[model samples]
Target: MTNTNRASIKIGGGVNGSKVEGGKIRTEKSTSSTENNVDIIIDKDVTNSAEIIGGEIHVSSDLKAEIQELLNELAKNPITRKEAVAIEVIKEHINDNPSLKQRLLSALKAGGTEALKAIFNHPVVSVSVETVKGFLEAS
Candidate 1:
């Protein structure tokens, strides 16, 4: 679900939590001094699929850096062959691995797009994966 979704989601006031299922994300208008917000908690079930998918989807640090060295690669660059492979892997993994998808999505947001790219570009992947794995497990 995309928080960008502008639908006015009418709901009961006493929500311990609110979340969108599947591809839909909900964003709510704010009444407090704080800004409007939407939150998506990564699901418990999606973790394994995300890891296997993310692993198969690797690209070289060189390729990732070349893409990031530019200005706003996400908006401007067509998906590179390198990225395409990863995307396909992710798509397949996410098909049934919602938990992993949520965890990865959580990571991507914990650090926004650029930081996410830098992490992906990390040269030492085993350590990087373990770091991410440990962080996820610890949490």
Candidate 2:
């Protein structure tokens, strides 16, 4: 005597993604996997939506010059240790995206509170927003 039997199982798919909107990020993630001889099929759809949120950091030319000077001073002042670390963090993130860095530079040049606020919202620079603002606004 001999017997044969089969089993079938179904699975749903998943999706993962991130979005930045109005200086904020909305993220979602879903995943599924199967093991053994069993066949698992999962279907998922992901959508990411975002609008560049940033404005000029409004600063006078003199203030901008001072900010530049302060940036140069980062290496000299031990008191700026936190600021230095934040700068490093921002640098590493920016290095991964040249265009983003350029955009940041342009924003800085334009000078507006919005620009500064936008930079503050960036994940890499979030922690250093105040430090960055201080450097840019310090007289």
Query: lDDT of all the models against the reference?
Result: 0.34, 0.39
Q: For candidate 2, lDDT tens digit of each residue in 35-109?
A: 112223335554444222322123233332333444545545555435567577455555565665555556555
Question: What is the alpha-carbon lDDT for the whole of candidate 2?
Answer: 0.39
Q: Where does candidate 2 have its weakest 10-residue lDDT segment?
A: 27-36
Best by TM-score: 2
lDDT of 1 by residue, 23-94 (tens): 222211233111112333443443332421111122233333332333233334345224444444334544
Off by over 4 Å in 2: 1-87, 122-126, 130-139
Superposition error at 56 for model 1 (Å): 28
Kindly state the number of residue pairs that clash in model 1: 10
In candidate 1 the C-alpha lDDT for residue 35 amounts to 16
- For model 1, what is the alpha-carbon lDDT of residue 8? 26
